[model samples]
Target: MGEKGECSGVKPSDDEIWAKLVPSDSRYSDVEIRSDEKVICSEISAAFGDKHSWCKIIRNSDLCSATVENKSPNTILVDGTEVHNENTVVIKDGSEIIPGPDKGGFVSYRFDILSSPETSQRQLQICVDVENAKCSICLNIWHDVVTVAPCLHNFCNGCFSEWLRRSQEKRSSVLCPQCRGVVQFVGKNHFLRTIAEDMLKADSSLRRSDEEVALLDTYSSVRSNLVIGSGKKNCRKRAHTPVDDQSDGTYLQCPQCVHEVGGFHCNNNTVHLQCQACGGMMPSRLGFNIPQYCSGCDRSFCGAYWHALGVTGSGPYPICSQDTLKPISEHSISRIPLLAHENNVHEQNITDSCIRQMGKTLQDVVSEWIVKLNNKEIDVTRLALNHVETINARTSVCCDCYQKLVSFLLYWFRISIPKYRLPPEASAREDCWYGYACRTQHHSEEHARKRNHVCRPTRGSNM
Candidate 1:
């Protein structure tokens, strides 16, 4: 009665009455109708729409994980950012498939998102959304969602364009849709423009866009001109300082915001350094920088110091909370790591457990470099500086090749250096190796240049 997938919202005794048929004109470009009798679709939306329709009519085809593209250039872009690249694939959903934008974006790994390998949580997709660089706005939420840019704010497309066109007639510029910064440019990364055009063409179901993004560059410059005569206001409310606050004399913070407070004003880096006036430390790390602009006042806060926002411990500062609240950042982000030194070595690269695999299949990574050095194909200086990484891994040397390698190491020592620096009263192989001095001496740059440290098997580690 109500097109193919439904029977007039009445109880259909058999699924044949309804359920098996899909309407010809679908609203979403992201979906496909594989069957004429019934659209292959997810049961969730289908049942919710037609309550009386029998549940059995919902098609139960397991969409195979396959990559698809436009048969010709007839390939319409479904969603600009969704399947943005030529390599993007559509995981089949029963007979229904996400329709177009059948091209764009490269893929790192094939994941069974809908029903296959559930290795990743469903939330992982949102992480991909945040990282999309094409759109510069902050809240890039699409499907009637928007990202705010220039002002770097997001508003619905309709909301933004209406706001922009109307606001242009009267004032120098309007405040941002979200932040209220005097607006300037939305730049080229206009996501709403893309979304509106694609949705209209595709006959989509996503809601309407609201507003455009803009930034006020001139305000800061004019304020810079006015800084000499501007009056300052002071609020007497004192923020609660924890008993366990660090002894660094940082007591001043924003009572309202709790970020760092500085000389009669607030600064962004107050997270790292204590406020000169109020002694409050602000937030610095955690993927966020300074917050000089306050949402309360259109003007930036100039203070004795900045506001403090973080909870502190005697050891390391507490993990910042701003990112923890977001669904995507919490689950998808990797922690900031320490600065890796040039000589830093990981334990996984070595260890007999890795080297002695089920049968120790030959891997020539380490051996190839050693052979190159022995042949003098490259410079010795680079070889010495780089050898640390290659040394730990097991060589691909066969028994015969291993013997030749051992001979080469010995031959290298004999030819390159005048002597192996044996003890005053001991042999090069005995006293030098047993001494603690050998470990220190051989590992140094100068010693490495004189003798190559090639991996040489000695009858299966008997040495």
Candidate 2:
């Protein structure tokens, strides 16, 4: 009876046993885990025992991590414990595994973690067509391609400049070559030029000779940005071009290029910025005491531009909405954005209630913080905006950019205050397990804000 009971003892399958075997110590540091299905260490295999199957690893769905299993009978140890044949041990990120017994010869493999799918996949070269990159007028790969609006046709700078010169000489209006509509605006398409160059580099046969390129360079008129004048269809009168405005040449000129604007006329060398929002041109007047360009993106916005000139969009050109750009002092926010607190709605709600309980408005809190920011009372060493070194309350920014700054500042404000100082309702909550890394933060706002998310594991956590 005893012998039968010993022989009939249940033996677990390798898959079943490995399924339940999780790593005793799941925290591994100083090791790199690979993405491959199996990474066998040849050095360890050669030094300790057989050259194959000494140590094997696979994705363990149960643990959501890689697991190391012993395939040989000789000896294997994970950390300091011995793992016999068919016995499995889960491997944590940055953990080390030994292929042989600790007494004699052994080889160690460090398991590393791959953070994202982008990092796991290898990059490949992108192919482009040379024929599609050619200019319609020149019938060749574009040499500094310029885009003409309204018709939305593309042409080489040299070819379009020559055509414009001829049209100005013979007709009252400059028209698009393909479609005879009066050209309203034209500018060099930097993006298309880059593609054309790449196509040429890929196929040298498509490149033009040096003499041809040099000749084209001479005819290139689309320099900086050009603001075309309005051509009257019924009136057969030639409009006098702006002073120093030569045909087929590039120069910066606002509406003042042709007429006086705000008692100022644009000259041949006037530096201008193209409004990113409206595509309108404005003189770069740093002395005008108005914000024309966004310090964050360095792009021009027309809101402050038009306001400073005491004019609106009723003129020939367009004007952007005033709400797009304004002085920081003029900006106001009544409700916190849904994106605050890493899009943790519960947390945002708590933050809101906490403010309300204190008898303060959102704007009031932000105003006080902004004053702190300008006074250099808070360290902006980690500001996440572009040109962080130059950005401050005095720097005018776009609406979207201003929101980002406010969000960052609010984060510092929330994390700096003592937990005990928080309203009683917020002070009693426990921190979440994942904290900032919680995946539920995006889907469940309540879970994100209900718990504290900024604590690390306490020592002896496993014990």
Summarize candidate 1's per-residue lDDT along 200-269 as a digit string, tens digits: 4454333333332233211111110011100113233576443333222222333323333242233322
Question: Would you estimate the TM-scores of all the predictions?
Answer: 0.20, 0.48
Most TM-score-accurate candidate: 2
lDDT of 2 by residue, 1-463 (tens): 0000000112323321111111112221112223334434332222454234555677655344676777756577786788888788877654556666673444344443433433322233456676677777889999989998778788899999898767756766678987777776677787888778877877899989999999998887555455554433223247744333334333333566667778887554344556778776676564577777666655568778777777687766557877778766677888887666666666676677767867899888888888888777877754556667766667788887778777766666677768886778678876654454444345433444556643332211111
Best by lDDT: 2
RMSD of each: 25.5, 14.7
Each prediction's whole-model lDDT (CA): 0.29, 0.62
Error of 2 at 94 (Å): 23
